[model samples]
Target: MKIHLRSSLLCIGLLVLTACQSTSSPSQNNSAKPHEIAALFNQSTPEYKPETEANRTDKNIDSDITSDSKPIVYDDLWQEVIANLAFDIVPTPRLQKRIDWYLKQPDYLLKVNKRAKPYLFHITQKIKQKGLPMDMVLLPFVESDFRPKVHSSQSAVGIWQLMDSTAYHFGVTTDEWYDGRQDVLASTDAALDYLVYLYQRFNGDWLHALAAYNTGEGRVKKAIRQSKKQGKQGYFWQLKLPSETADYVPKLLALSYLLQAKHPKFKVPKLPNYALTSEVDFAQRFDFSVLASLTGVSKNQLHRLNPGYLQHQSAPEGPHKILLPLTEKQLWQSEFFQRYFSQTYTVVKNDTFYGLARRFNTSVNTLMALNNKQTTLLKVGEVLKIKKAQPLDNLMLEYQVSPYLAQEEKKPVLTMEHEYIIQNGDSLWEISKQFNVPVKDLLTWNNLKSSSLLKPGKKLVLHLPRPAKTPKKPEPKKFLSELEQLVKPNTSP
Candidate 1:
């Protein structure tokens, strides 16, 4: 009877187990099974979706966490920047002072954030790809407040504030038509290359690299050597540096710290993670006015987006790439774009590729390729297509001048041309001081080098600003002292 009871009980247990398996949800069943649990572990992780406005909140930004408890990949570009911050700056008076200064001017930060939206994604992406510290992304903010076309009194140009020599050393070309220093794409690459080189040169010390970036590497090395001689390890903070260099690193550190803190009063302006601008390269030189018309983007906007182009048109040679709003990328690929911009000329007697190329402001190779010709030979009456170069005046009236171009326009044109012959013992410095111009400008104006020996009687061309007449101050009314008053009468008139 006991054996019979045991068998019945065992059968009941098996029946119960089967019933549970049948009634349980799939998820429950999976959780119960060992193999299913292993499969769950092997499953691919969920892909990150860009945060939507509905899902993004102040709490999400501050905590970087979702309601369901998943760590947010990124709520926006700012969040991404914050996540990648690798610096741990100890609080110092200078750092606190900078932080305090930034905190007081919340509006300034907002303005910079707004200006940075169009560029932050590209800059951040480059920094990420290079495995650089996120601090480098804010370097432009410190350099030029993110102004791509800004120039400093020290001759540093562009958002990177790259000096002329540094820009040239990094293969950034400058000419009357184009200044690569103002080209965000070219200058960013050059700046990062320089920073990486400095980082490596300083034995992987980022602070030292940054300081070297502010003041030259030679100065930083000298400071380090001086510190070492004084029986101290050469850290950036430990070494004595110029007031500017000392404040520079602290400012960067302060910015990084404040940004990471997620303060309520100081919020980073909302900018999407996606690129705001897309660079489109043309096969030949293109006109900005034509681009503006084609994309329905204003001329001012086009100029702001492509400040590298000094004039209304792109460089005659190449780098015919222009940054347009990413939304306009589709316009470039549309059939109408090609049909509208394309121009054709009928070949006449004695028509040659070279002549047509010169006439069209393009290259012979480009002309031949456009016409699908294997050789430079041209046949009469054959229609060959070319890119249209629009007239500047026709489009200049369509839109207001961009702030970048307006600043250029407002500059006092140095119209007065002067020819100065070098005198004996006249140094470039002395000549520059006498002319009230920079020595660098003197070198550039004369196509002379800093090391070039100035010879007597050598002529130098200078474009000086029109001299302003100084109003002579009326002679101060003569006042007689008490003793003089007693000695002589003073005129009241």
Candidate 2:
């Protein structure tokens, strides 16, 4: 009965794919069509595999169970990874080509191992929990070479190489102060969720899910439909896909094969099967410098573990968790540690509980509770106990950091000339607040008197601070003197 149901769904899926292909014109580029089909798949089928005793049975029973009921232990994580590989692929030229490419670069695996050491165990454990094919653990190797802070030309960031839209769709947050896409814990959860979603969307085809991950589900479904139209099986290998995507699945498969086979030419690096880092949850926003000082961990190590924090402090609005060395977990959880890290804020003029709540990314009720205040009213020059801490500049530069954070830290503040057109309902004071400039400064910049009448649609010259510029390397070029020297060499001694 189960087999029959699966067969029926497969036939329906094929029919839908082929029918969509038949109706679509060569010039038709409607992006909505693919999503419409995806929506159909979502509605027609269960989003997850049904739980059954047989399917729920652990596949790694050998290593996971023993006569005494104690699980067998492996010293190396790669060995554990090898024991659980579930995918089988026949060696083809394309697969061999990828394997050959890796074999030629002997140092590539070593570098990957170094970068992967901190996160691999955690990622592998997550895959195991999900009952996914173990090869999914290596997806980051192909995506970003295990670099969490890496960015692609397409604006994809992190080890998972998730684009902003996809990241947001999967609940990975991105903002000025934080980017969950680059957080190993956050991105891993989001990436795995997306993969599981794709797996179900493609009717349990892992290859299709992986290919879709590279190009997108829309394009992969379109390719499958085109293949079906041409009297093909519409399998991953048979479907016509973009060049990068065509190679993407094969590359992963080739790596999986090599790792499982333990190829003589290829050497796998030794990594412990235990987690190298653990998450430390905070009830409030914390400063990384203070974290470094309290935990005796270097700022560089903290930055590496918590790259999602764009500045020297955690996001004002946050998950409020940091990945730290497992050894330091005890230190972070100490009661004294929490008390020592408590921060304070002084109430200034025009400061209200509501305004302070928004500024500090907390709630007025929490503030009131902390201060034992009955009302939202606040006194000037009052000291309020706050959870958020301002970053110290001296501590921020104490150690080298990731390029992205370093760029953000050393970002320049430049003033640029702007021509603003006067709009309806505009006032000098309002414009000054809008641009974060004083009204007097605005008048001087525009060459206007205090009594000048504002007219709609009229241009006003204003000087405003420019956005932070990403530091770029100066392009190499030859000077005119060098060019002249090259053209005519001096013969004199």
lDDT agreement with native, every candidate: 0.63, 0.65
- The residue-by-residue lDDT of candidate 2 on 1-493, one tens digit each, is 0000111111122223433221111111211232333333333332322222111111221232334443346898888787666665556665789889778876667778887887788787655544456677889999877877766656677889987666665556776667777788678866876675676667666677889899988899999899889986676777788899988877887787788778888878888778887666665677676677766788779887877777667666676787776644454455434445565789899999888889878899888988889988877889998763333233233335556555545432333345678999999999999988999998887779989999999867676663455322222232222223222333789
TM-score (all chains, Cα) for each model: 0.55, 0.57
**Candidate 1 off by > 4 Å:** 1-72, 328-493
- Top candidate on TM-score is 2
Candidate 1, residue 258: lDDT = 83
Candidate 1: C-alpha lDDT:
0.63
TM-score (C-alpha, index-matched) for candidate 1: 0.55
lDDT, model 1, position 186: 73
